[model samples]
Target: MRASPADIESICLSLPEVELGISWGDRPTYKVPRGAKGRGFLLYRAPGKTAIDPVSGDMFTDLLVIQVADEMTKRTLVQDPQSPFFTIDHFNGYNAVLVQESRLGELERDQLVEIIADAWATKAPPRLVREYFANR
Candidate 1:
């Protein structure tokens, strides 16, 4: 039931018009095509100063940044103690959550899929969103 990086990539790319791009530090970012550029919905984060482990003071190397529909959703996810979703000060106002890949085992595969799909919907073109749901 645990999700892997491959599962994340597969679930993301399965959505309509999703594209893969390299982000800062050469991290893999998943986005939905919109116009001249795509809007990123998910990203594999490189270890940085802002997201260090409180216990070890070490940068987290396995972080995944997943976009949410809004700030409310971001707060809801990160506030839930049982949820694997979290956030750092760097994302104080951003509509996204950080999940360590190592902690992905806390979530079921279906949950992972749904999360990625929702992320896609938030950034996917409106026409694409309507069409995708209409066909489903």
Candidate 2:
């Protein structure tokens, strides 16, 4: 089933104090402001079951090491007392949640199957992904 624009809007508004926008991928992304640098989050949408379907938003990611620009900042994120996801600074405050352990159950298997089909289509025609975004 195709997702309605209203469906997308509902998801964005459900987030707490979120600022949403369409990213380069032509999918929804969000910016969450925090008191400190690199304390942001991305409301990223990844490929879904259908070539046109998109996964729901319900995941968070910590920074990775390689993404850190300087040694001091890297140490700060890694050593932060309230650190959630280790190596979070590596993401530079930009990460997407396409997979997670749902309380409901394992990931929706159907969702994965459709995503692969869409990915294959993209590989077969690079412009297809871009066009998909444009349509969204």
Candidate 3:
């Protein structure tokens, strides 16, 4: 089954202390509280020259940027040729992966949940992360 944008929003908001914030003008961003600051864990990316479809040479209009714990985690997600996760030159050296909203169906709903939850853990306070995992 295909996961929709609504599914993404729902999964992000379900995490502990997550907040919906507007970023890059009007794009939706999910952030987790850390002390006095809220760190973004996931966001809808705006189409630009950075990320484009090689085949069509067109900017991707429906991309989602999801944070990861480290470069290893980012590589693991995007290294698989069949994985919908990917990265562009603009994101090199960044601990995140980009996936088109349209390709979300390539992952199972549970898989989607796991990734989003993982993204949350990456930006969530250490105590919150420990508590969240401890309860689970």
Candidate 4:
């Protein structure tokens, strides 16, 4: 099951200045606008690490599952700049990252919500959310 696009939109709305976007695997993503740090919703994904871009305070994503932890060298699956594409972990690996652009979208709101919802269902933290949801 995939994430619903509307849920993706909801997540985006949860953040400030964040607009809906498509992720690497065509998953829903949020586009942070300039000045979002000042006005965008507060981010709580992962904290406490060497700041890579001090000016932005955004961590440079790497391949070691550090997108939620730390910065490390990473390989992107995205190839064509004209299209949404991205890959991770050598040529073929268990984990991968998708590249989606919030700047553009051909999908509709309802459709987006549905897709995002599905994606969120399988989102990582792996055994975390699933276990929590089950216990709930």
Candidate 5:
């Protein structure tokens, strides 16, 4: 029941103006335009050598990096032991959290949907945000 890459892609693309791109020409990344700039809100990030996966004694191949509204939100999510969110030293003070693919089953689909929507809203332009909220 773990969330798959297909789930992430569909959710991200469902948001207005989100585009599929690659991180370093490999990992999938989802971004939204902010004025003339494109901002990435959700990205597929693999654990680096600095962050070892305790279960495999190696780096994790499927970590999802999701942008949050602020550091407080990031801290709150990662600090909750029941939450599947986590972070590494590389993301210290960053306004994002990492969720492993294997642990996605711990979250319901609606939970993932809400997270994706919130992540998009956080990176979207003010005009887009206004339109999105107005339509809701």
Candidate 6:
């Protein structure tokens, strides 16, 4: 089954030290309480002028911006033909991938959990990361 926005929020909040916040007024954002300026790991994106549907020319409202460990990770996901993850011009030079909510069925629930956990680890402090891994 496809994941919903509520599912995303629940997964994000499941990570250690994750806090919910709003960005751009209402878009949901998840952050780790560590790192410079409190690292944001995930965001619900509303496509701006830079990101639009090629066929319909409409902005994507059900988009997610998920932070990856690095450019390589982002590239791998976006470049894979089977991956639901993609990127737009707005995300150039950024270590993140965009996924459509409606297309989330492309990934299994456990896969989604791993992605979110990896994202949290990228933003989470070493101590927290160590603790998380030790528990697992």
> Global lDDT of each model?
0.87, 0.33, 0.88, 0.34, 0.82, 0.84
Task: Assess candidate 4 and give its TM-score to the true structure.
Answer: 0.27
Q: 56-78 in candidate 1: lDDT tens per residue?
A: 98999999999999999898888
If candidate 3 were superposed on the true structure by all CA atoms, what would the RMSD be? Answer: 1.8
C-alpha RMSD between model 6 and the true structure: 2.3
- Cα shift from native, residue 78, model 4 (Å): 8.7
Ranking by TM-score: 3, 1, 6, 5, 4, 2
Off by over 4 Å in 5: 1-5, 24-26, 34-36
Itemize residue pairs with steric clashes in candidate 2.
30-43, 49-114, 62-88, 63-87, 63-88, 63-89, 63-90, 64-90, 64-91
Tens digits of per-residue lDDT, candidate 2, 12-125, equal 334333345454456544433211221223333343322121243423321111123344544554465543213322244532212221211222334323332232232223
Q: TM-score of each candidate?
A: 0.92, 0.24, 0.92, 0.27, 0.87, 0.89
Ranking 2 against 6 by TM-score, winner: 6
Q: Give one digit per residue, the lDDT tens place, for model 3 in 1-136.
A: 6566669878887788989886667887898883348888899899999999999999999999999989999899999988899999899988999999998888888889988999999989999999988987
Colliding residue pairs in candidate 5: none
Taking all chains together, the TM-score of candidate 2 against the true structure is: 0.24
Model 3 score (lDDT): 0.88
Error of 4 at 42 (Å): 15
* Candidate 3: Cα lDDT at 3: 67
Q: Which order, best to worst by lDDT?
A: 3, 1, 6, 5, 4, 2
lDDT head-to-head 3 vs 5, winner: 3
**Residue 94, candidate 2: alpha-carbon lDDT:** 33
Return the TM-score for candidate 1, rounded to 2 decimals. Answer: 0.92
Name the TM-score of candidate 6. 0.89
* Model 1 weakest 10-residue run by lDDT: 31-40
